[model samples]
Target: MSPEPLRSIHVVAGVISDARGRILLARRTEGRDLAGRWEFPGGKREAGETEAEALIRELQEELGITAEIGEPIINVPQQYPDKRLRLDVRRVLSWKGNPRGHEGQALAWVAPEKLPRYVMPPADRPVVAALLHPDRYLVTPSPADVDDETWLGALQRALESGVRRLQLRMPGVDAERRRRLARAAVEASQRAGVEVLINSDIGLARELGAGVHLRAAQLPELSVRPLPDAQPVAASCHTGEELRRAEDLGCDFAALGSVRETASHPGGSVLGWEGFARLREAVSLPIYAIGGLQPDHILEARQHGAQGIAAIRGLWAD
Candidate 1:
């Protein structure tokens, strides 16, 4: 017979942003699990409480403030040694009264960019990514046949369509032409205040002072991260072992999938949402659901514990 399912806790949290663009965080009280680690303020949802209702009540009880909770930002599912945690985060549209430590927890208002510096529980990390990182990661198709002008034009269009993070993936193209395209793409992405990562090319990435996205094969070949902290490093992972290695290599995020059959990988194994979530629980790195995905799937992806959706054809423009 199958073993009993692990007990799960449904917790609600709120992202309280001030006019200065800082987020409010509360330190876990001394005796709590993960004590002293900062997190978005809130608590476990009691039965019969809606996520919004739970968040509102939690804010009032923990911080002595009444919150008008807004839309859901992300729902993160994490597995611990003892139990499972489902963290539902929402936006705090507005609130009344000064936020103080009603429960004796220390309070901090941190800048969005600096949230990484403060240690947090595994479930809270993905919520931070949802708030600061883009919901789409656009991977460029090979530019081997297309002229320079046509390829760059498509890149420009993708940027205008709100692709904040990008991967310059030209797998079959020759090195020289790829470098030429990379130089131009990097220049255009920088002008638009977007971050571009080179796919499987550490030297080029270093030369261009850009980020790198490693292939799964490269995960075990390197002991240290290829780039500095200022330059992001991403990876493509297919299994929990690969995901763990990517995490060990200090990858900022990972792209996992073949979530569905696609033209590129016909009949390849598809993870489906359940498989994706299962692997997601094994690591803490923010992940993007790739393969046969489009912009419309971002909400579904996030619900399944993905950071966002990563796509080539789905995001590519003419």
Candidate 2:
């Protein structure tokens, strides 16, 4: 006989912003799991309750406010040792009355930018990313075929088109040329206020004062994070084990896919949305669905527990 499947504990959380743009957080009372940790004020979704209804009830019970729930933000699926957890977060457009912790827990309103400073539960971390990070993480096409000027010009166009996060990946390019292009890309990205990552080259990433995006093979080579916490580090993962390792190494984000077939890898196995969700359930990292995805798929990606879409051709401005 087959083994029993794991059951997921569906949890709902609300992002309630104040007039000054600060968001609310509540401390978990002692004697509870993850006690003393600060988290978005919410609770489990009881049977027969919609996500909005659950959030509304949780807010009233925990924060003493009647919330007006808004659209979905990001649904995170994470696996803890004891149980599988799904954290569904939504924006609270408005609420009635002042918010006071009704359960003897402490409450604080935090600025969106300062959210990372507060220690939160593993499942709650991705909610912070969904609130603050961009919905698209652009991975550039290899620069082997294009001239430096032409490639850089396209990159400039991508930045102008609202690409806030990017990775410079140039497979098969010579070491000298790769460094030169990375230097140029880093300069351009800094000017545009975009976060740029160098693919699989820790030395270059450090030299440029940029982030690093590790290839899957590089995960086993280093036990510690290659750069400082101030510099974002990302990874490419195909399996749950790989994703777990990436999380263990403190990768800020990850790209997982071939969610659909693409011209670049015609015969590559596709994870589709379901497969992506399955892998996403194993970790708490913000993930971008790669391969055959465009900016238009952001909503669908979010629905399947993705931070956003990561693409090369789809994002590279023609």
Candidate 3:
């Protein structure tokens, strides 16, 4: 039988930053669940407390600083077997006083890219990805039908529009043609300051000084991360098991779903918004809702805990 649904306890957290782009993290005390693990500093909401109120209060008590909470950035709902936690995280845009571990816990101000080096509780994982990347992910559809010039032009235009993260996937091409396309795409992306990943091609990604995006089937066979820590590694995940594997393998982010129908996969089984939320709640990694999402669904997707939306046709057409 399936486990019973966990009752959520609302907790407010803050991603406090300093002038040098460093985020503050605190170690849990001796008596809490997952103690000694590092996490974004904040605490549970008291009776009738608003999110901002609770966040500010928690920061003052725990960090010995007066925090100015910005609008709620993201809400993370996680199941911990014994309990469920809804971590309502916000950006602490500014604050007063030097942040200290008033509760006698350890504290660190870490660079955003170096956050992955520190071990954290499961729930804090996604927040790291969200901090570093606050933009949509673009996936290029098959370029076989379109001419090379036309395809590259469309991709360059999209990159110019601030699509910072991209995955280039072109199937049914000869190995030589694929490499040529990959090289061209990476060149175009670099000029616009975008990070590029190759779909399930480890060697090619390495050769291009790019990243690798693993297909779900690739997760189980790998015992170690495919790329060096300096590079990014992403995965395509569908279920809780896949997500867990992605974490174990040390992926940077995941593109999850068929959250809605799309022309690419006509009449495909769709996860819908609610199904997407259920799957999202199961893991801590940043997820980009795939399947048929457009730019407009970004807010709604984030509302359900996705970091951002990842699209093929949606991004290409736009």
Candidate 4:
């Protein structure tokens, strides 16, 4: 039997900032749907209200503050077991009143780096990731397939370009070869404080203290997290179901794409920008829009609720 159609709940939330560069968070009051969970302080949109208007109203009502809503970022679309949600998160440009919890909920203003210490609601997790993580992800063009030094050189260049997160993907290679390259990649990445993931290899990921990226094919086989809770576990997802699976399996993030047609996969059905936004709204994990993308897409990706863009080509072609 098919699941019931999701009832979409549109919400407008705000990331309020202060002069010291800290962001505000609010805890849900008791008896709410996500009671006790921390969130970017704001509320649902009342009918006939614009997103910015709703945000301003929600902030004034909930926190007894008047805020000027700024640019929208990370327009998240997430689904709970019972209902779906569209969390439109905008940055609060400025405010005139002190932000105090008028509804008895607690509010805290903390540095962005400290956001991970707070236990946020599921839908807000990706928003936090977007706030703290790099917008672009580099998936090494199949290490072996790219020829010996081509990939390694590209790896160094990409890291030098300030790509802080990367993945090394190689398949059907000898164990020894895979180990050699993984070690090299890991070593190269750590020198720059880059977080690297080894594709589909739990043993290698653990041995190297790196993360593991599960392919879509690996999703159905996992019953629990494949790595230590502290280690990042990202997944490749092409559908909402796959994104849900990634979230359920305790993935740190997921990449969803091919956002547009690529030379490599000509005529393949593309998600486009709108399609990416729609799929992104369906899940909470930070998602990177992949396939046929470039540096300029970063801002657009964030606007549509993505951590950023992921790519194999052009990412390293400096």
TM-score of each: 0.96, 0.96, 0.90, 0.88
Instruction: Give the Cα error of residue 206 in candidate 3, in Å.
Output: 3.1
Q: What is the C-alpha lDDT profile of model 1 across 157-217, one tens digit per residue?
A: 9999888999999977888899999999999999999999999999999999899999999
What lDDT does candidate 2 reach at residue 130? 89
Per-model C-alpha RMSD: 1.5, 1.5, 2.4, 2.8
Deviating ranges (above 4 Å) for candidate 2: 1-4
Give Cα-based local distance difference scores for all models.
0.92, 0.92, 0.86, 0.87
Candidate no. 3 TM-score: 0.90
Which has the higher TM-score value, candidate number 1 or candidate number 2?
1
Model 2 local distance difference test score? 0.92
Tens digits of per-residue lDDT, candidate 4, 158-210, equal 89989999989877667897788889889999998999999998888999999
Q: Give per-residue lDDT, candidate 3, residue 56.
A: 95
